[model samples]
Target: MDGSITGHRPRAAAPVGADGLAARRGEAVERAALPAARRPGTAGSESDTPAANALDGMPRQRTARAAAATPTALSAGTVANATAPVPSALSADPAAASGAPAPSAAPARARRPGSPAARAAQAVGRLLPTPFGTPFTFGYALVLTVTSYVAGHADPAVVRALHQASSTDVAHLVRYPVAVLFASALWIVGGILSPYAAGFLLVLTALERRIGGVRAAGVFLLGHVVATLATEVPVGLAVWAGHLPGSSLHRFDYGISFGVAASVGALAGLLSPWLRWPLLALFGSVLAEGLILLDDPMTNWGHLLALALGVATWPLVRRAARARAAAPTAAAA
Candidate 1:
C-alpha cells in the first residue's frame, strides 16, 4: 500500500513539465497584479500582503478626499451666485436692488429780480396796504386831503397857480382832462379846511368795501364827469342865449360832492329797507329845501342828476350778488 501511494505521487509530479511551469508563473504574476479583495476565493481574507493592502486603501483614500472637497466647491459656487449683479429688468428700482434709496430730483430755479412777475408782485404788495385797508378809495381820500391841506395853507400865488392848473372850467376841460379829474377832488371850502375830506372818507371807503375798488372808482368818476358836463353845458347854453354872462364858462366848477351824492344813492339800494328809506328821505328833503330856497339851483340839479345815475347801478350790484351766490356751486362741480 505504501509503494502504491508513492507511485501515484511521482506520476502526478511527472505531468508538471516546462509548459505547466510557465503557466504557473503567469498565474503568479496575475495574482500579484490584482488586489487581494479581487482575488478568487479570497475576498474576505485577513492575512493580506502589504501591496494588496495599499491597493485596496487607494480607492478609500480617493473617495474620502473627494467627499472632503465637495463642501468647499459648493460654497465657492454659492458665493459666486450671491455676488452677481441684478439686471435692470429684474428690479423695478435699480437703487433698491443695490440696497440704497433713490436720489431726490433737483429743485426748480428761482425767478429773476427784474422779471415782470416780480415787478407785478411788488406793485401789488405796495398798493395792498395803502389807506389802512381800503387801498384805492381811502388812498385817494388821503391824497385829496393832503393836496387840499397843502393848497389851503400855501402862499396865495401857489394856491392861484394850483387852481389854474387843476381847474375843471368848461374852457379848460378840453385841454386838461386828467388834471381836472384829479384836481376836482382836492378843493378846500372857505380857503381853510376841506369839508369834503370827511365825506369822501366815509362814503368812498364804505362804497369801495361793498363793491370792489374798480367798481367804486368807476362810479365816482362817472358821477363826477357826468354831473360836471350836465351842469356846465346848460350854463354854456344859457350864456349863449344871453340869459347869463360869459363869465359862467370860466367858473371854478370842481368838488367831490356830486360823486358822494351818487355813491350814497347807489348804496341806498344795497341797504335794508329801514335804512334805505330813511337815507333817501333825508337826502331828498335836503335837496328839495336847497331847490325851494333857490340856494344854488345848478348845484342842487347836479346832485339830483348824480343820484339818479347812482340808483341806476342796482342792476350791476344784483348781477354781482347772483355771481357770488353761484360761485360755491360751480366750484363743487
Candidate 2:
C-alpha cells in the first residue's frame, strides 16, 4: 500500500515536467509581472511591461493594430513617444526638413538719374494742361494776324509776286517765311508782336507735331486759300462794279492774314468740342471793337470762311487719319 501510493504520487507529478515547467514559468512570470501590474502607473493594465517596450519587439503590423485598438487619448502620446528618435536630424535644417531650399538674401536695386523716364516725366510736366486753358490754335491764329500786318504794308508789287509764286514755292515758305518776315517786323516795332509770335509758334508747332508738318501745312494753306477767295473775290467784284471804292488794285493790302487766321480758327473748332464759347468770344470781340473801340476794322467773313473750309475738309482728314492708323498694321503683317 505504501509502494502504490508513492508510485501514483510520482506518476501524477511526472506529467508536470515540461508542461509543469511552462506552467510554473508562466506563474512565475505572472508573479514577477504582479508588481508592475499592481503599480499605480501600470494599474489595471493587461500588459505587464510599459507600452513602449511591449511594442519594441513586436511585429509592426500587430503593434499598429494594437495601437489602433487603443483609445485616441493614449494614441497621441504613443505616437509622439514612438517618433522621439526622429527630431534631432529634422532640427538641423528646418528648410531641408520641409523639402525646399533656404531663400537667398535679395540684392539691392540700383537707382538712375536723368533717365529717359525722367525726361519723359519732365516733358509731361512741361506739357501739362494750363490753368488759363488757352488752346494752341488761338495762338497760331494770332500769328496769322501779325502776318497780315506785315503783308498789309508790303508794296502791292511784292504782294503780287508772292501771290503769283508756284504752289510748291508758296507751300515751302508759307508759315515760317511769314512768321519771320512779317512777325519779326512787328516785334521790332515794339508793339504786341512778341505775344503774337509766341502764341503763333506754340500753336502751330503743336498742330504740326500732331498732324505731321507736311499735312498741317497743307491744311493751313487749304483753309487760307479758301478764305482768301471768299473774302477777296467779293471785295474785288464790289470794287470793280464801283459799289466799293478801294483795293481792286490789290487784295494783299489787308494781307493774307485772314486766310491764315481762318486756317487756325478752323483747327480750333476741329480740335476743341467746346468751340461755341471761344468762337463767340472771338466774334464778339471783333463786333465790340468795331462798335465801341476800333470801329470794327476786321471782317468776320474770313473766320466764317475758315470754319466752312475746315468742316468741308473733315472727310479728307478722317481718311488720312485712318490711312495713317492702318499703315503700321499693314506693314507688320
Candidate 3:
C-alpha cells in the first residue's frame, strides 16, 4: 500500500448509504408511511440516476415530442378538405345489392289457365302420358271401330267396302292399331262390356309399352291365331274324323272378335300377378264368364286357350318386365 504508483492518499470505503444516507433513509420511511408511494424499487433509488429523470419527466417529455413531430398548425381549408363527406358514387348503397327491386321481376308475366296457349300446351301434354297411360290412341280406335260396325251394318255395301279396304290396305299396319280400332267398336256397343273391354285395353297398352310395340303385337297376334285354330281345328277334325254333327267352326263367327278377345285374355293373364287383387278379380271374373256363358262357340275355348297361351308366354313377358325394372335402377345408379 505505501509503494503505490502515484502518491494518492487512501480514502476509507464508505458504508452502503454513504451518499446522503440520512435523507435517503428519511425518504424511504416517508414512502413506506404513504401506501401509494411505497413501491419496492422506488424506495431505494440513487439521487443522480437517469431512471429517476425518466420517471419524473416521462409524460411531459412524450407530449412535447409528439407535438413537435406532428403537423399541429394545419390551414382551415386543409382541415375542411380532410374532414369533408365523400361523393355518392364513392359511398356504398345499401339497397342495390339485395333489397332493391329486381330487374327480372319487373318484366315477368303470370300465366292464366284459360289462355289459348295454355289449352294448346295441355292438349299436347295429354298425348304424352297420363297417370293411367296413353288412352288417346285407344279412344280413337274405339270411335273408328264402333262407327264402322253399327254404320256398316246399316249399309251392307259399306261393310263390304270396309272389309276390302281393311284386308287390302290397312291389314299390313301394326296389329295394335287394328286391335285398338276393334276395341273402340266394342266400346260403343260395350254397355256392361265396358269393364271387360277397359281392362283389356289397359292390359294390352301396358304390355305393349313394356315389351316393344312389335313384340307385343306379335304376342297378341300369336294368341289370337292360336285361339282361332284351337276352335277351328277341333271342329275340322271332328268333321274330318267323322265324330259327329254339322260343321261347328264354320257355324261360329270365327272372325276377329273371338281372336282379339282371346288376345285380351292372354294379356290380362300375363299382367295378373302385378295387379294383385284387382287383376286377380278381373281374371277370375272373365274366366268364369267364358266358362258360364258358353253362348258364343268361340267364347268357351277362346278365353281358356288365351289364358293358357299367356302362361306359356310368361318367359318373354318376365324378361321384358325385368328389363323395364332394371332400366330405372340403372338410371338411378
Candidate 4:
C-alpha cells in the first residue's frame, strides 16, 4: 500500500525563501493601497490619508482632519482646544492682538491748481458776498444806484443827450460799438423805482448763490451783449433795407432791463418744481404782454430775447451749482 501511494514529499513545504518573499510583497501592496482607500469619495473616506502610515513620517494632505478623526485617549476638553479656530484678523496680523491703530485714509485735495474748476472754487469762497451773497450783483447795483442818483439830479437836457449818445442804435454802434454798448447799461430808463431794479435784486441774488458770482456775472453780460446785438442788428438791417426810416437808427434805448430779464430766466431753472413753472409763467407773461402791445418794438423784442438767452444757460448753471455746492466743503476741509 505504501508503494502504491504517490510520495511527492508534500511539495517540499514551498521553499521558505520564496514563501517569505511573497508574504513581504503582499504587505507592501496593502500599505500602498491603504491611503488610496481612505481618500475622498470611497466607503473608507473618513480620513484623506492613512492614519497608520504616520510611522513613515510622510506628509499628509489634511493632517488636522486626519488627527481629529483618529481615536485618542485624551480628554474631550483637550480635543476641543486643539480644534478651536484662530481668528483670521489675528492670524494674519501678529500685532492685531496688541491693539495697534490702523492707518486712516488720506484727505481730499483742497483745490485743483490752475484749472477752471479751481478758479470757480476760489471765486465761491473768496468773492461770495455776505448778507447778500452776491458780490457781482451788489457791486453792479451799487454802481447803478450812484448813476441813477446822478441822472435824477443832472439837467434833463444833458441826461437826454447822454441817453441818445449811449443808445445801442445803428448810428451809435456804427460810430462806437464798445463805448455805447457798455455805457447803455449804466442808466435805468425809469429810475431806481423801475421794475428792473426789484427784479435785478431778487433774481441775481438767488442766481449768484447757485452758480458762483463769476458765472452769474457771465450770464448777465452774455445776455446783455447778445440781446443788444440781436435787437440793434435787426434795426441796422431795416435801415439799410429801407424797411423803416433812417431816423430809426437813433432810437433811445438805454437800460439794464435785458440783463435783468436774463437773470430772471436763469433763476427760474434753479427754483423747486412747484415754484419753477409758476415763476416762468409769471415772468414770461409779463414779457409776452409788452411784446403783444408792440410798444417800443426794439426794447420789447430785446427783453424776450434776453429771457430766451438765459433759458439756454440751464446746463451751464446746473454744473456751476454742483461745483459751488461742493466748494465750501472742500475749502472747509
Candidate 2 achieves a global lDDT of: 0.48
Ranking by lDDT: 4, 1, 3, 2
TM-score of each: 0.56, 0.40, 0.44, 0.60
What would the per-residue lDDT of candidate 1 be over residues 1-333, giving only the tens digit for each residue? 655555444233345688877886566445444454654335465544566555521222123344345443244556687766555657888786885666777877887569898889976554432465567776776666677677767898987777776667767776776778777766645532544555566667766656667777888877888887788778878988999998877877676778877887877877789998898888878778888899789988988888888889878855664665687799999
lDDT of each: 0.70, 0.48, 0.51, 0.78
Question: Candidate 1 or 2, higher TM-score?
Answer: 1
Query: What is candidate 4's CA lDDT for residue 58?
Result: 34
Worst 10 residues of 3 by lDDT: 165-174
- For each candidate, how many residue pairs have backbone atoms clashing (under 3 Å)? 0, 2, 3, 0
Of the candidates shown, which would achieve the greatest lDDT relative to the real structure? 4
lDDT of 3 by residue, 1-333 (tens): 677688687666555555666776555444343322333333344433466555532222223244334454344666788855444544365444444543454765777569898889976664333434434335534654565465435576865444433331122223444543343233222332445444445555666556645555666667655665565556657766778465342342222444345445445545556664475466657676867877654456666776667666767776876787799899999
Candidate 4 lDDT over residue span 39-106, tens digit each:
44234665434454443323333344553454542447776887554445535555444455444568
lDDT of 4 at 50: 49
User: Cα deviation of 107 in candidate 2 (Å)?
Assistant: 9.0
Q: In model 4, which runs have C-alpha deviations exceeding 4 angstroms? A: 1-132
Colliding pairs, model 4 = none
Which residue pairs in model 1 clash with each other? none
Q: Give candidate 1 misplaced runs (Cα > 4 Å).
A: 1-133, 188-195, 321-333
What would you estimate as the lDDT of candidate 3?
0.51
RMSD of each: 17.1, 14.5, 17.0, 15.1
- Candidate 2 residues 49-135, lDDT tens each? 567345432222223344345354253566678734443464777775665666677876777579898899977644432323333
